[model samples]
Target: MPWLARSRPLFPAALLTASWWGKVLEGGRAAPRNGRCVMAPVRAVVRLRRRVCLQRKRRVLGPPAGPEAAVAAGAPGPGGGSPGQPRFFTFDDPAALPARTPRKRRRRSRVVLYPDGARRCRPRAERRSSRAQRCLLLLVAIVGFQVLNAIENLDDNAQRYDLDGLEKALQRAVFGQPAAVARIVALLRDYLATHVHSRPLLLALLGPSGVGKSHVGRLLAGHFGAVLEDRSLVLQYHAGHHCPEARAVQLCGDELERSVADVVARAEAEEKTPLVLLDQVELMPGALLDRVLGLLQPQRPHPFQNAIYVLLSGAGGAEVTRFVLQNVTRAAPGETQDEAHAGPRAHQTDMELRAGLRALLAGAHPLWQAAAIVPFLLLDRHSVVSCFQEEMAGEGFFPEQARAERLAAQLSYYRVAGHEFAVTGCKQVVAKVNLL
Candidate 1:
């Protein structure tokens, strides 16, 4: 009778029991036996669960129309408000709520100062010191290498023979071309003095075979302390066959440029002036000749600024010889020779040489026209005799001067018309001396 007095007439006991059992199972507790009243703890849990469910349903369905409607729908008011007044909920202060166990903050590694005034992170200091040491070591190594390189360069420069001595040596080594020798020496002197950018020294050695064209180049190479036979800095191409054909070639366009650039780069890296000797250049095809000339053009920066190009051509050899012979002073019917006569004759010879060379190269490219033509004159009997003597002395073939002179005299000399001619120049002389 008491339970009936507290219970609402609209509420069903079966629904309440089922809901209570559901909440107990949801809370991970076993449901009690059937037909038994729930315990006090279970009843409190069911009351709280019912309150939460009623609040959620009110939110979704919106608030009931009035307290009577709420009570009729079996929705309890907060703190069991009277049926006449609207229910109002109150919240406890966040600070007054049960304090949560404070989560422990992870301590980050930090650089701490010790009582001894040293940093606590020794590894960081060690790392910094090690990095500084490595940088210092690298810098020192770089400086040392540069110093050694500079010293080596200085020593090399110091060891080089003076240009004057080199010129004299070249003159002695190459015979029968005094004018050519003097001009070459002057050219070299000018090149050394005024190394104007983009203007490389070009020498065209024009003469017959065995007239010391190649020998002059060798002398120049030796003067510069470079080995002419070495193909690195001194590029020697026998243009007759060794030069690549213009159309039928492996390396062309960019490949050709790269190859040439690589060679020039190597010479520059070694601080050496590249010397290019094109032997029998007249025999080279027009295309290949143009390619070589393009390297010397001034439009772009090139390693050829310090380079020396020696072009050996036998094409104009006959004209050179004829021009030299025609300029020889043969007193015109008792005209007395004097110092004035000597100057005029020398001037006339130079004029004839230039004229002849110009005529010979008129059909060729302008590049060849701009070159300094050095005529390697045919060696006279005297020069050839001297060459023979020098060779004999070198080989220890003739310790006695008398034997060398006799052998030189016995060598057959050719006669063209009335003038004496050493047809093979110093080549035959050297051979004759070697044979003896």
Candidate 2:
């Protein structure tokens, strides 16, 4: 009764009407009336009734089987599911899920090889140093090449011969041709003054052999600081042997043309005029003569605009000499002066000589029309004597003036005649003096 009195107040009036409540009340009546014991059976009976109620509720609503069931029952899912937990759908076969592509692995680069079969893994500093060295070598080579070219082009002897020196040499070296010397000096002056023009100064030296035609060319080259012996700036071509044929193949082939062009181009680059001496020009082939003439034409493209071309021809030497001798003097009856005093007469004679020579050359070849014909006069007995004395004096032969004069007179008497002068001019005289 005491246990019932303690338990009856704690149980709800609704649960007291249940069978387990009725059993708990019957057990309470069997206990001692005065004892405050036997409440353990009542507590067990209440726990069994609560478990039975939970089983009945599970049967009615069904246990949670999926994510939806878990969410609806408010039960915690995987990974700490709370009230607002995000539910993940589970696939039975993992293949049903979207596939994840595997990542690509990076490949290592291969080493490069050098020309000597060595690996090319040079450091940055070493590579830069090698590049700088190559550049330096190239620069040094370029500078050396330029310096050599400049040195080769410079003419050391050019400044040694002046206009005055040129005139003195012409007078001393070339004898018995006063008119020729004057004309040459004048022509050179004119050429130097007007060389900037397009046309070249063309001279036709017409006379017999050994008449200083080639000698004059040599003197001019020497005066201008050109190499006379080596034929660098002075191009000498003897038609008969040197230029054997008109055809390029027969005349040393293509090499000859290249050499000529190279010389002219070099002279032009140096701002100097080149001298082209054509010896025995009359003997050259007509085709070759025409080609040479074409270079002087105003409309043609040629490297000889700044050049001085001397055509030495013995073709009409006799005719030239006959003309000079006939017109040597044109004095009046009262005038006993020499040919030097007859200024007007001398001018007229020169004009006639040039006209005659021009006519003769024009008859043989048309190229002579562009040239100024200059006659190298034949040396007289007096001029021959003076030439012999000058040459002997220079050579240290016949040092005494009186002895030299006597030897010169004897030589002139033996070698020269009254009407016919020395054909070889001073050439044979020099050779004889050398023998003495």
Steric overlap count per candidate: 0, 0
Indicate the residue-level lDDT of 358 in model 1.
77
List where candidate 1 sits over 4 angstroms from the true fold: 1-161, 194-196, 226-231, 244-260, 270-272, 330-344, 399-419
Query: What TM-score number comes out for model 1?
Result: 0.54
For model 2 the TM-score comes to: 0.54
Model 1: per-residue Cα lDDT over 1-436, one tens digit each: 3443354531455456568778897987776676446555445554655666676676566656555777776756544853543555546553454544435689999965568865555566555657788899999999999999876855554334256787788768777676677777877666654323467778888887777887887776665544323467666667546645554533443444455676667776765566667787877766666677777788646675667788888878788667545544452433321221344465566556767887778687766787888777666566666777778778876546676567657654554434444666776666676666
Alpha carbon deviation, residue 280, candidate 1 (Å)? 1.8
Q: Candidate 1, residue 345: CA error in Å?
A: 3.3
Model 2, span 14-85: residue lDDT tens: 354455557767786453554324455556555545455555555666555555665455555665665443
lDDT of 1 at 218: 73
Query: Global lDDT of each model?
Result: 0.64, 0.64
* List of clashing residue pairs for candidate 2: none
Per-residue error for 170 in candidate 1, Å, reads 1.2
Candidate 2 wrongly placed segments (more than 4 Å): 1-161, 226-231, 244-256, 328-344, 399-420
